[model samples]
Target chain A: MLSIKDLKVNIEDKMILKGINLDVKPGEVHAIMGPNGSGKSTLGNVIAGKEDYEITGGSMEYLGEDLSELDVDERAQKGVFLSFQYPVEIPGVSMSNFLKQILNTSRKVRGLEELNPMETLKFLREKVNMIGMNEQMLKRSLNDGFSGGEKKRNEILQMAVLEPKLAILDETDSGLDIDALKVVAEGVNALRDGERSFVVITHYQRLLNYIVPDYVHVLHEGRIVKSGDKSLALELEEKGYDWIKDELAATV
Target chain B: MQQTVIDINKEAYQRFDALFGSFEASLNGQKSNPFHQIRQSAFEKLNTLQFPTLRHEDWKYTSVQRILKHKYVLEDTSMTISSLPEVAKMPDVDAIRLVFVNGVYQSHLSDNLNQVEGLSAFSVEDAMNHEVYNKVLSSRLTSEVDENTNPFFQLNTAFSRSGMFINVDKNVVIEKPIQIVHISQSGDSPKLSAPLFVFNVEQSAVLNVVESYISTETNSENPVLNTSHCFYNLAKQAKCNTYKLQKLSDDHYLIHDIKADQDRDSVFTSFTADLGGAIIRNNINAIHGDENILTNLYGVLLGLGTQHVDNQTLIDHAKPHCQSNEWYKCILDDRARGVFNGKVMVRQDAQKINAFQQNNALILSDTARMDAKPQLEIFADDVRCSHGATIGQIDEDAVFYLRSRGLSRRDAMLMLQLAFLQEVTDFIEHNGIRDFMVNNIVSSFEKIV
Candidate 1:
């Protein structure tokens, strides 16, 4: 569903991501674990077609289209979702109105009939219920003045509503409590159809316990140094990223 | 500095002088009555207070050269209209409508003043004969001449014979808003309409007024210079909210001035929405007459194409324990220009006063310009006053955030701008008027994208 080969990226004049290669087929879940400044979020943003970085070399592809050619909205219209690490406050735009716009637009782009307000409300209410958000939340500004957990829940709610093909989860568990984590994980797990894919980026392994990954990749200093399965996440939890770094140093 | 003897735009000033000369000449060389004295006094004052220039500190950003170059007929009487224009009517508004076409009152199109209880309305020329009404109008007129100090104010006063006088009795609340529609239709050449409106809300009375300035000639080439001066006098414990919307031909000019006075324990609020006109200048002033008064002034100016909208507001806290709040926002697109100068004055004796003023603008195009100047002059040691101005482009982060959710870039921008404007438009206290204005505001922003 997604492929990246030798993707070297620079933000300013400074290089951030050296060479990187990744591939995800349908229904596969991949967890990218790394410490701070490991370019994990940068990879997520680049995949989502954020226009800040310079792709000096290499190519990123999604569904046979060059990722860089598509705008942020075009990629989104094609079912690529990036759950932000810090959700922005969309002031004055209400939550329900915003969601209805998203649902209708996404549906229209997919050659589906746009939902009427009533149908849109019904569809949104169902998903909003799945995330356990109150109906009152639909009236407030989009994630504005919301708690950290509510923002994450809102992102997850948007992902469920959009029903994207490839969803990049950027530190979705950073500020969430264990209960909120379970709710978020459950929300993601519900959308885990056989055709959908996820690349969960995180700094810790706590979230992996709820949303178990099919594969785990340890990104160290702009490079994915280690790749393993679910037990690898468990191993990293018991030890640490330094455990992998030491092993890499010995191997070198 | 050496005084250059060739110091004025003499040609432009002479044209107005010639117009006034013809107006007086047509009077058959007979100038009688106190009202004519008022007009004559204002005419003389207008020469001294000629049109403001760029050198004037208050008129720095905006030049009156366009107004000066255009020739106006002083007042247009050639309009023989049968029906009111559709744009003057607000959807679902049950108002006591008063229609004035080319500054001439349309009796057939207006509500009968005698039928409404606790309400008195008359033409300004007729009001001069009524003893009590004359006092109410002159008190404000005399003070404006002494203190307001605006050239447009003087110019409008010279032609102040054109408007209406509305007075709500003591302890009475007007059940519905009084809608005053000024429809500008061009005459033979270019024309001008300067109507003076005075509204008196007596002690403990409540009044709601919605004023609309619209042009019947939509996109016509012959532009009109329409000037208006409205005085709102709120007696002790009175409440008044006056909302104005100016939508005219893009080549037209509108200079509006509003002076409001709040007595002890009274409340006054004013909202203005400028959607059209090549050059629109709004001068709004509110002063506290006694302590414990509250004044709130809010506006939203939307400029598209080459439209220029300027709002200059002043709130004077002359008494202690009074509060004033001013919030104005502008959205400028294309090569349009917007200027906001909101000044708040707290006197030394006005202890414990609270004043807050903010002006924000969203400039869409790179060539579009916005100048926001907020002035707060506070002398009281115990007063609280904070004023700020912010001019910025649309928040790209918010735009991208919306666009990434599958919205087109245009839709995202329109939504963000509407949301930005909603913060101020939502403060309209009346629900029906607010909804209508907000809907109009939405449609206007949609056209921008």
Candidate 2:
């Protein structure tokens, strides 16, 4: 469902992602592990069509359509979702309204029937309950004065409501307690299926325990140096990233 | 030192001298009437009071030199109050109707409000002819004029010809707000009109006044100037709410001076929304006269084109245990400029006072300008007084966040502006008034974005 060939990205004229190649098919989950400044989050943002990053050279195809030609909203409409590392607080837009707008916009862009207010409300309630958020939280302004855990849960609720084809979780586990991490993972696990795919990006392997990725890739200096099964995450967590850095240096 | 002193009060003295020489003898003859005597005293106080300048801490960012330099001819005779344009078609609001055309009462356009029990509403002419009007003004306009803080108010009394007077009897809760409509019309020439409005709330009585300014005809080349002074008096245990809607055209300049006095256990709430006018200056002052008094003031100014809106507010806690809250917001687009100055003062004896003030502005374009200053002066150390001011563009992150949800860029900006101004619009107590305010806000947004 997602494919990238020699993806290169530059921010402020400084190369962040150089020659990154990855592919994820439906019915599978992929996890990317990298140390600080290893270009893990930068890859996710570039895929999500952030305008600040210049895609120097790349061909990214999602669901048989060229992703580079689309803007952020267009990419989102095509079932590409990015869970931001930091969820922005919009002071006056309610969570339910924001979620409804996203869902309807996505549906409309795909030539699907749009849900009415009542139908949207029902969908939002079910997702709210599934994500363990109170109805009052949905009524308040989006992310305004919300705790870190609540903001992460809010992002997960949005993902569930939109039901995107490919979701890139970027540091959703950071700043979350163990309980919050489990809740967020549970929300992600609930959406796991043969027709949906996920790209989990994190430094720790703890979130992988709950989401349970099918493949693990170690990213270093904007290149995927190692690729293996789920056990690779466990091994990297145990020995840390230096072991992989040493192996790459020895190979070079 | 002598040169500096002379330069300090140059503009103020010129204005004072012009007004004094124009109407000193006429005001002296009308002192036999108590209201006229009060007016005369106010004129004397205007002479003693000095106009604040950039040196003043609160007026540091605002410049009023141009306003003071122009010698405005205060017209006494009534100008033609032409029929208003059919654009603003609102249903008849069931309240006491008072009409002022170029600062003169237009009896033809007013309804007979005397039939309403316990409610006395009429133009200054009605009060001038009736014996009971003297009684109402004598009991209502009973304020010892403050010279320093409100010099323009005294000037209003010194120059105002006819005024709007309303009295809600004791223990009578007025359901429908008293509506006073002031309309300015452009004729063959430009004109200047100064009107003074007074509303007296008896003990335990509730009064809501909806005062709106509308222009019947707008001529850019021959524009008119309309200045208004309004004083509100709430007795012990009385409640009063004032909502002023300024929707004049771009061909008009309005200067409004509003003074409100709250007695012991009284509550005064005011919401001022400025949507029109070429240049509008609003000066609002609320005084908590006794202990346990409460005061709340909120304002929103949405301007487009070359419109300029300036709001200055002062809340004085004179007695102990008073509370005051102030919030003002503005949205400016094109070449519009907005200014806000909110000052909260807690007196020495006014211990345990609680006062909070916030002034926030959002500039939509690079050419738009916003000047906001929130000032707090606390003589008593035991009071809770805080003030904050912010001038910034809309949050880029929030805009991007909304745009990612498929809202067009223009729609996202309009939503943000609406939410920013709704904080003040929601303070309208009456449903009809609130709807009117909402519609006005939406129209202003439409013109800009």
Candidate 3:
């Protein structure tokens, strides 16, 4: 569902992601583990088409079409979702209104009929139940005063409503309690299907316990240094990134 | 222009001197009093002071260059209210009705809301002619006179022959609001309309006053100068709420002066709405007479086309433990212009005074302009006073978030604008007026959308 060939990205004059290549097929959940400054979030943001990062070289393709040329909203319409590490708080825009706008706009792009206010309200009730979100959250402004866990959960709820083809959860495990982590992972697992995929980016292997990945990639700097299966997550949790760095140093 | 000013200045003095000379002969020296003499002295003092030019500090934002060019005819012609251009139809006016046309009173169309007991309304001419009305005008106008930097007050007093005055007796609370309506039918011809309001509330008396200015006739592209001087005197522990809605024709020019004196423990709240006029200037002053008084001033301006609106407010904390608040918002579309200047002055003996001023504006179009200056002068050290101003366009992220939900770009923009203005509209105390404003806003939004 997603492919990247030596994608080099720069923010300002500094290089953030240099010569990185990766791929993920449908129904596959991939986890990328890296330490601080490993470009883990940068890779996800670039793929989601955030305009801040300049694509210096190479290309990124999603479902066999070029993704680098698309805008953030256009990418979102094509079923590419990004669970921001820090979701922006937009005042004066209600959460339900924001969610309904995104869902209907995305559906319209896919040739689906628009939903009335009543239909949209009913649609939101089921998704709210799935994430265990209070209905009051919909009445308030978009993430105006939400807690860290609530913001994360709100993102997951949006993912469920949009039903994107590929969702990149950028450090969704950070700043969340254990119970919230469990709920979020469960929400992600519920959305899993044969035609959908996910790229989970995290610093620890704790989230891997909930939503086990089919492929584990060790990202050292900007490139994937090693590729393995679920056992790799357990290994990294025990030894940390130092063990992988030592191994890479020896190989170099 | 130098030669022209010299000639116009001399002519102006001669014109006024001849007119007052005729009035003095007609009165036969009947006007005699310590306060009336003081008013006459102030009127004399105004003859030497020039009508403010653009070079003046207070008049810098609003230009009256065109008014200075034409010679205004001081006439006694009365215009019927039916001749006025219709906007929002006036509500059923069951209260006291005060009417002013071209700065003179029309007693035929006015009714005294306080005809029963402790309240009374009268025209200045009748007040000056009859002993009863003369006593009320002389006592109220000269007693609460604000002898400050404003020259318009002196100009109005000097030129005004007839004014309307309303007084609520001590300890008497008026149930219905007193309505003062000034209808102008002056065309491109230079005109001066000096309408006066005087309210004296005794201890514990409550009063609500709603005033409006509407032009009856005018050339759509020309200017008509209209001036007003209003004074409110609230005794100790008295409370008053005043609202001034300016919906005059965009072809009219206005100079409004509002001054209020609040006694100890008194409270005053004022809301001014400016949605019309080619050039509008407001000078509002509030003075706390004793300790522990509260005064608030709120306003909103919606300007379109080339209309110009300027609001200048001054809050004077004269005694200890006084509080004052001011907030003004302006939304400008097309090439309209808006200016706001709010100043708070805390006197030397005023300690523990709390004052806050905030001015915000939204520019809906690229050509629209807004300027805001919040000034504070504090002579006391132990006080908490703050002021801030912000000017910006619509929030892009907020717009995108709404657009992503399914609303078209236009609908989303309209929703954001409505939300931005909801705070000020919430302050409207009259449901009918509030709904009328909302309907106008929605209709205008359709064009902008």
Candidate 4:
């Protein structure tokens, strides 16, 4: 469902992501693990069409269409979702209003009728229950003073409400406690309906145990140097990322 | 041949001088009235003081060249209006409506004074002639005699022919608000109207006043210039809330002066929203008469196009244990300019006073400008006084965050801007007025950016 061929990206004059290639089929979960500054989050942001990074070379395709043609909002409307490492705290827009706006706009773009206020509330309440978020939180501003765990859980709640075709979780488990991580993983697990796909980017192998990726890839520098089944996660967890750096140096 | 702004201003002064003569002559038998001395002194002060130039610190950010370049109809005859303009209508607000067209009170459109209990309304002539009301107007007018006095207020005092005198009896609470609508309209040249409003809330009384300024026509070449002033005097333990909504045409001009005094344990809260007009200025001053006064001065402004909104506020703590809170927020876009100057003073004997003042501004366009100055003077030994000013742009990161969630760029910007203003509007306890103001402010902001 998603393909990247020799993709190169840059911020200002500095190269962040060097040449890389990857592919994922529908209904598959691909976990990319790397040390800090290894371009794991850069790849997710590139797919989400963030404005800072310039795609210096190559092409990325989703659903047989070029991803560069869509704006950030257009990409979101076309079912490309990115769960930010730090969800922004918007102090004026209420959570319910934000959720309702995104849902209705995405629905209209996808050729669905806009939900009435009652239906929207009902839809939001079910998603709220699925994520175990406080129902009263909707009355407050969007993440104005939410706890770290609550912020991560709020991202998952947004992901559930939007129901994107391809989701990118960028360090979603970094700030979560074990219980919060369990809840977030369960929320993601519930949404894994055969056709929906995910690219899970994480620094630790613990999240893989909850979501259970179909494949694991070790990103070093900018390229995906290693790819294997779920067992690779256990190996990396035991050996640490230094094992991948040593192997790359020996190969070079 | 083109005329310079200087020559146009000279012409304006000559026109004002001529109009003052007509005003004095028209007083007829009332030339010996008690207020005549106040008018004579004000006219002398007006002539002694030149029009404020940019070099002056008070007028540093705002230039009145745009106002001085035109000729106004200072001696316009009476005009007839069939009905109230749509802009002045408050459908959800149940109140006493007082309409003024071209500075003359239209009794036909206003509520009858005899119908309302514990309320007395009179014209300027009747009030100045009244023995009891004369002292109230006299003490307020002659109290401030300084070189720093604004020439516009002096102009209003010198030439104003029509105004209102409203009094609330002691221990009476006016259930409905008093809505004062100042409508400026002219079929020919730009008209200049100065109307005065004097309000006295007796001891233990409660009153709410909502004053609005609107123009029927919005011609850049022939807009109306409305120079109005209001005096609010609250007696001991009295409570008064004054709300001013200035939504004149974009080309119109308004200069309003609000003077208020609070006696012991009185509470005075003011809310001023400046959303329209080419150039508008509001000079608000509130002083403490005794101990335990609570004063709140809150203002919100949305400036677009070449519109300019300047709000100058002063809260004086003269007695012990008085508290004053002030918050002013402004949003400027498309070359609009805004200015906020808030001053809080604690006198020497005013111990244990708590005064807080804050000014926040959001500039949407790069060309949009805002100048905020907060001044605090505390001579008292023990007092808690604080002042702050913050000028910022729309958070680009917040915009990107909203856009990433499927909102268009415009929607994202509007959301952030609206949120920036909601903090101040949420303080309004009246839900209906808050919603009405929010709707109007949002619609105007949407049209700009």
Candidate 5:
């Protein structure tokens, strides 16, 4: 469903991603584990068509179509979602109204009829309840004053609402507690379907305990140095990333 | 520094002189009243004072040269009420509407004034003879003088003989808002419509007033100029809310002046929304007459095409324990220009005062301009006063956030613009009026896009 071949990215004359390659089939969950400054989040942002990074080499193909020419919104309309590590706070825009606009716009792009206020409320209430969020949060400004966990949950809620084909969770478990992490993982697991794919980027394997991955890849120095099964996550958690670094140094 | 001398427009002065003669003739028997003397002095002052130039600090961003070049007529009795353009009335508002054609109050188009209890609404000429109105007018006329030298205000006072006066009785709350609609139909001639409105809210009374300016001359080669003045006096513990909506045609110029005096423990709020006009200038001033008064001045200006909207506001905190908050936002598109000059003054004795002023603008086009100057002059040491002014394009981060959520670039930008305006529109106490204003702002934004 998604393919990245030898991706080299730079931002303001500084290289963030040197060379990266990843492939994901439909219904597959891929976890990308990396230490700090390993460019895991950059890959997720580039895949979501963020404009800040410059793709120096290679290409990204989503559903067999080149994504370099598409805008952020166009990519989103085509069912690509990125759950930000740090969500933006937009004041004066209520959460529900923001969601309704996005849902209606996406629907319009897909040649579907728009939902009215009542229909939108019903749909939002169901998703909101499933995520165990307070109804009052929907009336507040979109993530304006929300806590870190609340923002993460709001992001997951947006993911469920948008129902993207390819969802990228960029450190979604970074600032969440154990209980919050389980709730988020459960939310993500509930939305998983046979046709949807996810690329979860994280530094630790604690989140993998809740939502198991089909494949685990260790990203070191902007390159995917190791690829293995879900057992790799448990091994990394026990042995740490020093073994991977030592192996890379020995090969060099 | 050498003092520069301003040359007044001779032709414009001649035209104003002839119009003033006509205005005096229209007054007829009321020429002997003391108010007529005030009009004569104001006319004299207007004649002596030259039109403000770019050298003037207050008129730096705006120029009256185009408006002064035309020889405007005072009265256009040739046009009938049916010839005026239709203004969509707000739905679900049980308002008492007073319609005026060419600055002349049209009783036929107005609702029955007798239905309102504890309220006396009449033409200025008729109200001058009543004892209650005379008492209020005599005391307010002296207090109503403009603090600054503005030629338009003097000109409006000179020619505004046929105006309206409303007096609310003590402890009476007017359930329905009084809607004053001023429609200018200058036909082919470049006319000047000057209307003066006076409102007196007695002690413990509550009143809501809305004044809307509109024009009907769609094909006139020369632009019509409408200069209107409204004076509101709120007595002790009274509450007054006034809204001024300027939606004239693009071929017109509007100068609206509103001054309110708040007595002890009274509250006064003014909302001015400028949607359309070639050149629109609103001068809103408020004064605290006694201790513990609250004043709010909020406005929104949406300018498109070559529109020019200037808002000059002053909140004078002369009494102790008074609080005033002022917020004005503008959205300028195309080559439109917006100007905001807000001043807050805390007198020496006005201790324990709180005053805040903010002006924000979004310049949507390369040629669009915004000039915002927020000034605070506090003579009292024990006061909290702050002012802020921002002139910028749309927030790029906010735009990107909206776009990333599936909105197009244009929709995202428009949504952010509306959100910026919503900060000021949320201050409207009446929901119907707020919605109407928001809808108007949205439609205006659509035109800009």
Candidate 6:
């Protein structure tokens, strides 16, 4: 579903992501874990075409097309979703309106008819219910004064509504409590169909227990040093990230 | 700079002298009327005070030199309101429509005046004959204004002939709104019109007044200048809401002044929407008399092309426990310019006063400019007064968020700009009026890139 070859990224003359390579097939759930400042979130942002980072030397192909050629919105229209580490708070725009615009835009881009107001409302209600969010929350301003957990749930609700082909969950479990984590995981797990791919990025192994991943990769210093199965996350949590760092230092 | 200043003042005086001669000739036997003294004083004041220059504090950001240079004939010809464009009428809302053509009242175009009990609507000439006119006019006229402060208001006071006089009796609530429409028609000649309006709300009365300004047959070379003045007097426990919508042609100039006085427990609310004009300036001032007064001033200015819009507001809290809130927003695109100067004053004896003022502007183009000045003066110790002003472009992150949701870049920018304006437009209490204003705002966005 996605391919990256020798991905090299930089921001303001400082290299963030060195030469790195990754590949994912259809219906595969890949988990990327790393400590702070390990460039885990940068990979998600670059895949979503955030425009701030400069791809010094790299090639990202999504569904056999060059991803760098498309803008952020174009990428979104083409079934690419990035659940932001911190979702932006847009004042004066209701969540329902925001969701409807995105869904209709994506549908139009995919050669589908746009939904009317009533139909859109119904669709939004179902997706909102699936995410276990209050109906009142959808009517409020888009994340203007929402709690951290509510923002995460809203992001999941958007992901469910859009039904993106590739979803990148960047730190979606950072600020959530146990209950919120369960709800968010349940929401994500419900959307896991046979054709959709997800890249879950986190700092801990707690979220893997809920939405178990098909593969686990440890990112250190912008490079994937190790790749394993879901059990690797439990082992890394029992030990610490320093063990991997010490081993890399000894190997270098 | 000095040469241009001297030339502007000289031409202004020459034109005013010529216009005054024609004005006096039209008065005929009414020269001996009681208002004649007031007009004479105002005329003398006009001659003594030169037109405002950029050196003046209030006129620092705006210049009236171009408007003063035109040779404007006083438009006294009366035309039927039906001759005006259909856009002049707001038909969706149930209102008592009073139409004025070239600053003169058109009785044929007005609705039935007897529909609302205890509500009196009349032209200045007809109201002058009534006994209550003198009392109402003398109660608040020229109480808070002078020639030194606003020369255009002085000009309106000096030459206003056919104006509107509306009064609501005590304990009466007018169910329908009263709309006063001023339509200017200048045919191949630069025209000038001065229209004054006086509104009196008796004790415990409730009323809403809407003033709309529009023009027909506006010529670029022969521009029309409309200098309008309005006075609103609210008695004890009375509530009044005034809405002014200025949508003139691009070649026309408008100078609007509104003065309001509130007694004990009276509430005054004003909404000013400036959409189109070459140069539009709105001066709003409110003064509290007794205790427990509430005042709200909301304004929205949208400028395109080379249009210039200026809004200056002042709220004086003289009584104790009075509250005043003000919010003004502006959207400028192309080479347009906007200015906002809001001032809140809490007097020495006005203890426990709460006053808040905010002005925000969004510049859509690199050439567009905005100047916002929010000032607060608190002389009382037990007062809570705050003022804020922000001049910025649209938020990039917010725009990106909308774009990420599949909106085109243009639609995203427009959505954010409309949201910025909704903060002020949402204060409209009438649903029909609010929707009409929102539609106007949406259409105005189409004119920009």
lDDT of 2 by residue, B231-347 (tens): 788899999988888899987888888888788999998999899998788888898889999999989998889888989888988899998888898988899999887878888
Q: List native contact recovery per candidate, as a fraction of 1.
A: 0.70, 0.32, 0.12, 0.64, 0.50, 0.46
Model 5: how far is B394 from its true place, Å?
2.3
Per-residue lDDT tens digits for candidate 6, residues B1-449, read 35687687788878888888888888899887756666777777777776899999999999999888888887655546555467666657888888887677777777866668988877665666678776667444544334236888878878888766888999999978888888867667787889988888999999988888888777889888899998888999999998988888899999999888899999999999888989999999999999999999999988999999999999988989999999999999999999999988889999999999999999889999998888778889999898889889988877776666557788788878887888789899988778777777787788778
- Estimate the TM-score of every prediction: 0.95, 0.84, 0.74, 0.95, 0.95, 0.94
In model 6, what lDDT does residue A119 have? 94
Candidate 2: lDDT of A130?
91
Q: Which stretches of candidate 6 lie over 4 Å from their true place?
A: B1-3, B29-32, B81-92, B101-109, B142-148, B184-186, B215-218
DockQ of each: 0.71, 0.35, 0.15, 0.71, 0.63, 0.54
Off by over 4 Å in 1: B1-8, B25-33, B186-188, B218-221
What is the TM-score, restricted to chain A, for candidate 4? 0.98
TM-score of chain A of each: 0.98, 0.97, 0.98, 0.98, 0.98, 0.99
What tens digits encode model 2's per-residue C-alpha lDDT throughout A39-137? 999999888877889989978999888898987777777788888889888776667767887778777777989999999899889999898889899
TM-score of chain A of 3: 0.98
- Candidate 3 reaches a DockQ of 0.15
B1-449 per-residue lDDT for model 5 (tens digits) = 63233434666778789878877787678898777876887888776775788888888889887788787876654445753345647666678988877777676778875678988887776777787688778566544443348889888888885677888999999999898888866566777888888998999999998888877666447677889888898999999998888888787899888889889999999998998999899998899989999999999998999999999998999989999999999999999999999988889999999998999998888999999888788899999998899888877777776777778899888877888888899999999888877877887777765
The local distance difference test score of model 2 is 0.80
* Per-residue C-alpha lDDT of model 5 across residues A90-198, encoded as one tens digit per residue: 7777788788998888889899999999999999999998887888898898889899999999999998888899999999999999989999999999988888999
lDDT of 4 by residue, A65-107 (tens): 8998888998888888999988889897889988999899989
Clashing pairs in 4: none
Question: Candidate 4: where are CA atoms >4 Å away?
Answer: B1-10, B26-33, B74-77, B144-148
* lDDT of each residue in B1-449, candidate 1, tens digit only: 74232234566667777887787776563356556677777778877876777778899989877666666676544455799888888887888998887677787898886578899987666777788898877666666776656878877777654567888999999988999898877756677778888888999999989999888775345678888998888999999999998888687889998988889999999999998888999999898989999999999988999899999999988999999889999999999999999888888999999899999999898989999898888888998898888999888888778877878888899888888888898899789899878877876776775
